[model samples]
Target: MMKIAVIGTGYVGLSTGVCLAEIGHHVTCIDIDINKINLLQLGNSPIYEPGMEQLLTKNIENGKLLFSTTHKEGLQGVEVIILAVGTPQGENGAADLTILQQAAKDIADYLHNNPIIVIKSTVPVGTNDSIKEMLEDHCKKEILIVSNPEFLRQGSAIYDTMNPDRIIIGSYKKEASEKIQKMYSPLNAPVLITSVRSAEMIKYASNAFLANKISYINFIANLCEQVGANVDEVSMGIGKDKRIGNAFLQAGIGYGGSCFPKDVKALLHTSLQFGLNASLLEETIAINDSQQELLVVKALQRFGSLNEKKVALLGLAFKPETDDMREAPSIKIAKQLTKMGAEVAAYDPAAIDNAKKILGDIISYTQSIKDAIKNADAIFIVTEWKEIKNIELSSVLKEAKLPIIFDGRNCLNKTKIMECDSIEYYSIGRPAIIKK
Candidate 1:
């Protein structure tokens, strides 16, 4: 088994650490946050990924997984080091690689042997080569630098890592590629070996393309509304074609979360740096940024005077099964409602704590889905959580002062919502469902 050390216990690093250990490799996940390390040492996950905590507990018990806050202490005798640090978006649209550069220096300073250093973060092209040079400057001995960008989704990280569609191994050195491939050899997934530059471009391009699909469908959905057409039906029709396929085609509020928004912008800036005009991505970002304000516009049209009106904001996080709200539409929707003098009560399964840090006492946070919608004048379903999707509209009407819903995610079924005569429902890509 490859003794691996994964740095930065954020969403990607933590998931990779646990999945690597589960595959029979002895792995240690290190982070700078002492509080997070304390929690992980006690078998609790700082970030919420499905099936991570239980798997982390099992791996710790079996002596395959370990946690630490110090890189110097964590790298002793580790044959391979994976840098899974954050590449946050800088002020000018490029990905800030400050953390990644520091991680490379730390690995070089503490290395006991000539171990392979893998870049698991989604970095810009040529970053791996720069890391190799940085390491050589710090260490007397030569070290191998490999680019192995991760494609794990936030919610289904474990499943995606264990059963990846394809594993990308980008290395300049053949020996370095072989060593990294052996680390994930147990999974038996198809591994693609390419140049380091290609691998870096692959990560940025893959995410940028997915972001394009979302914005394209949303633009189409808006056009469908204008033409009295249904986007859901249109999406289904186009999805049947072999070329289009059916992924990232769901028409709703624009893309958010950690990867799509930032990566697409990063790719755009990278292209610009090379004097290339990336118009499609530039428009994609513009559309997504405007999409966040869509629900507020609709709400204002439906109710001109929102002063003293109670609006229930459902789903705080950008998506379901995770508590990350980096670019969630709910952020804008809640602030807009409050700006218009409307009372906002919000509920999310996992992101409430994080939301509180950003939202503060401006809006009231509720305990249950029913509580968020109850006693409210209007409802805005921003997230597609399973709990919110399965809620009874009749029960909502009985509890709420008014039975009006604006489904941003289109979570509620239109046909079923139409069965009730007292409810006024509005969703994406379809005509508003109103009571006679």
Candidate 2:
């Protein structure tokens, strides 16, 4: 088993380290946050991901997983160092490399043993090469750099990592490529070895394309509403074709979470930097921005104004099964509701604490779906959490003051809503059931 050191203890780093250790590798995950390191040492995951804490506790008990705040301590005797630091969006939508640059500098101090530097962070094209240059310049030795970008969903990161569709290893050196291949050999997934730049581009290209699919479907969803065509049926019809997979065909309040939004903007920034026409990406982002506000527009159109109306929002996190609220559509929706003088009460099985930080006391936080919707004039389904999706319409009609609902994610069944004659149901790209 290989000894590996992973920098940063965020979602990507922690998930990668835990899964690697699960596959029988000795892994030390280092983070600058002392609290995160301490919590991890006690077998607690700082982030919420399915089956992460179990694997983390298991690996730690098996002596396969480790955590530290210092790079020197974590880097000692490690054969591979995976850089999974955050590259948040900076000015003009380009990826900010300040944190990554600092990590490289810190890693350079402990590179006495030649270790393969694997970049598991999602970066722009040619970033791996630039990092290689920086590391070599700092250490004054030739270092092998491998661009091994991660393709993890926020909610199912552990499953995605362990059961990856394909592992793309990008490195010029045959030794570096083979070493990364050997590291992940236990997974038995298909491996694609390519140039570093191409590998870096692959990550952005893949995420942007998924974002494009989301925007494309949302674009069609808007048309379906105008033409009285059901988006669900249209999505299913188009998705049946093998060439057009049904992955991101769900027409919702645009694509959110950490990956799709940032990657699309970063790629658009890259295209503009190279003097290329990227109007499609531009429009993709434009469609998403408008989609986020679609529910609010509907609410305003329905009530004429949201002056002190008690509006209950179901689901605050970007998606289900995770507490990640970065770039979540609920943020915009909450702010708009509050601005329009709506008393917003939001409920999420997870992400309430995180949402409170961003939302503050502007809106009330509810413990359950029933608590959020009780006595509300209107209800808006933001995230399609199972808890929110399984909410009984009978209870809603009994509890709500207005029994009017706007589903942003299309979580409820239209057929069920049609069966109920007293309730009003509105959803994205679907005909509204306004039988009150």
Per-model TM-score, in order, reads 0.98, 0.98
Cα lDDT tens digits, model 1, 136-164, are 87786687889999999888999999999
| Cα lDDT, model 1, residue 284 | 93
lDDT, candidate 2, 1-436, per-residue tens: 9999999989999999999999999999999999999999999999999999899889999999999888889999999999999999988899998999888988998989899999989899888889899888888889899999999988999999999999999999999999999999999999999999999999999999999999999999999999999999999999999999899999999878888988999999999999999999999999999999999999998999998999999999999999989999999999999998899999999999999999999999999999999999999999999878888999998899999999999989777787786998889888888886
Worst 10-residue lDDT window, candidate 2 = 412-421
Cα lDDT, all candidates: 0.90, 0.93
Q: Name the top lDDT candidate.
A: 2
Report the C-alpha displacement of residue 340, candidate 1, in angstroms.
Answer: 1.3
